[model samples]
Target: MRIAVIGGGISGLVAAYRLRQRLGADADIVVLEQGGRVGGVLHTRELAGEPVDLGAEAFVGRRPEVIELMSELGLDDQLVRPAGKRPLIWAQGSAHPLPGRTLMGIPSDAESLRGLVDDATFDQVATEPQRPLHWEPGADIDVQTLVGDRFGSQVVERSVDPLLGGVYAGISASIGICAALPTLATALDNGASSLTEAVRTAMPAPSSAPVFGGLRDGYGALIAALTAASGARFVTTMAATRVARAPGGWVVDPIGAVDAVVIATPAPVTARLLHHVAPVAARAAAGIELSSSALVAMALPRETPLPDNSGILIATGEPLRAKAFTLSSRKWPHLAEREVALVRASFGRLGDDKPLFWTDEDLIAAAVADLSTVTGIPIAPIEVVVQRWPGGLPQYAPGHVERIAALESAIADLDGIAVAGAYLHGVGVPACVASGTAAARRVATACIENTQR
Candidate 1:
């Protein structure tokens, strides 16, 4: 049986790899990637004689899938914990350390947010527990609306917006609380009187292990390892334009017939391919919005004294153009062994227009200026690497989870066909891995059933 996996990003690669493991030598598998290379947003580049991630830098260590994948790839020993984790929030023309006990900027204790919010806002938050929770169970609401209603707009702007922006690259006012922060959402659904208490109760206990994990080499290593192990034929620079139902199973346009198929590309591309076969699912996929952003990596002199924190997140209304910054050398001690300091600055988000419109040089200049302003240091980098991701992050609007479920149901009727990627579930690396693996399992099950019949 021939199986086709479209889109060669980590999700697609994982789907293809898992499929090979399940079917073994009996199946004919082909991976179709439109780009010349794999890895998608997991690109890594060499700078100052060290491998630095230009795309996603790390994955949440608490998620077992990524760690398990690393171990399977024999990258267990290469897993390195971050040297620093705490990041500051740049606001009110000053840098304030983020509170320790908070989930996605939602404080578990009002006193923990003393310096971060104004006195009026603090008073409002202090009284939130006594205000009597009023929320519809299982109903989706924008993050800002919920958090703002309970704690006022100040907390949402100074605290929640920055943290959510770092992840979704979208505005908190539009992002669904349930989709973005499920723990908090569950607590709200359960009628938790205080969001702070709810988040605190839901948060896991602090562990000795680092919150995030990255490969000593780079995430690119994972892509390479998966490709080598998948044992699937790769067809790079070949985009699958369509997926139509065939007599026995399915046909991937320009890629010939396949008994099974996994559409692992972005939602828009997935929608286009599945349009004729599953119009309802295609419509749901197309409705999901995407956000764009750019990252500027700079190599500064080793002697430069960067901030002690891991990095600084720019709160909304700050005088800086960049939304976030990562002190790569400081966060990962291994990078500091080199003769240069590595730093990455991120620009743009859902409602922002500059990053999409700015030239590479403009982005670099803007990043440098913002970094200097925040750190109070005169910045001059020896080298700069700019990476732009257009529509990189999918916006999880209200009812996103439900919409995905409906899409899944719509496509479930088709035999040996499944969709997977960051768009289907959570957007993190681990979530994508799970989504891809699950899709592979579904296709494998269908293939087995077809043969039996």
Candidate 2:
């Protein structure tokens, strides 16, 4: 039973691993990775003689997928949580405490955003419940449009944009509420009279468990474990050029005939592969857009005197080049033990990807200058690493939910092949893991039925 898993990202790797567990020793699972290595955007590297994640640093621990997978892989010992510190919002040329108990930066009450916004905006948010709201049930629109109309531009720009940018690598103006903030959307659908009420109703109940988790060594550990456990033949630097219907099953180009295929690539690449087999699905995927981003990880002196906060998020309209700063040493307890302080400066977004083209030296300089401006500290880096992620994140634009639904429906009847990636339900590591597991189940089930026949 030969199977092919294309892409080699978290989604693809998880699919291959799941397939191995389901199909056992007899199945031949091949992972085709176009890059020199696996882990697509989940790459980790050494910095100052210690492993640090160059791509995604953490996963939402509240989500069961990552934690459960860690336990299954005997990697629970490597799990580490954050220090429960909150990030600050850099706006209006000052740093303000990020509004608490808010739903993705949308304030549940005016008090949360009191000092963050100006007097006028604060007053508007305070009286927001008094203002009548008209929301169409089952409607979808950008977060900025919905929040801006009710809470004013400051709430969307200063409060919401930064948080959304951190998640989507895009601004609130491009992110849809239905997918980005499902709980709030359901609240609005259930007849919430105001945006404030929706946010309040949608806020997650307080829990003692940490919100995020990460591997002690880095994501590279997780990737290495998944690759080994999958027991799949790794085909590095090989891109699956085509996937077409073959007698009894399918033929994956260069990989030959296989009982099944998991196309877990980026949206554009997935669209291209599905074009011949699932044209409608291809069009839907092709319509989905991607956002680029860059990161500058700097290791400064251990006594750099950085703020006590977790990180600083930049608001829209801010003059700063960096979108956010993750104080690695402050945020993660495990990293605090390092001899030097670690900070990661994020750059680029959906509309602005100029930083991706900037040289590593330029990116490092911007990160240094911005860190100095935000922290009021003299900038000096003992070591630096710059990583560029072009087309890294898929924008969950307005109508995204509907588009994905249609795409999935169009491919429902395609036998022995399935699609999965960040472009699906979410862009987070947990979401990708879920998508891959589901894809493997679908493919494995189909392969079994064929064998029975």
What are the Cα lDDT values of the candidates? 0.88, 0.94
**lDDT tens per residue, model 1, 1-453:** 899999899888999999989998878989999988888888988876677898888899888999999899888887888886688999899999887678888877789898988999999988887877777789898888888888988888888899888888887886897788887778777877677667876777888777898888998889899999898899998899889999999989898889999999999999999899999999999989888899999999999989977889988888789999999888887777889999999998987756868888899899989999999999999988888888888899999989898899999888899998887789899999999999999999999989898
Question: In candidate 2, where is summed lDDT lowest over 10 consecutive residues?
Answer: 107-116
Each prediction's TM-score against the native? 0.97, 0.99
Residues 233-322, candidate 2, lDDT per residue (tens digit)? 999998999999999889999989998999999999999999999999999999889999999999999999999999999999999999
Number of backbone collisions per candidate: 0, 0
TM for candidate 1 is 0.97
Q: Score candidate 2 by TM-score against the native.
A: 0.99
In model 1, which regions exceed 4 Å deviation? none
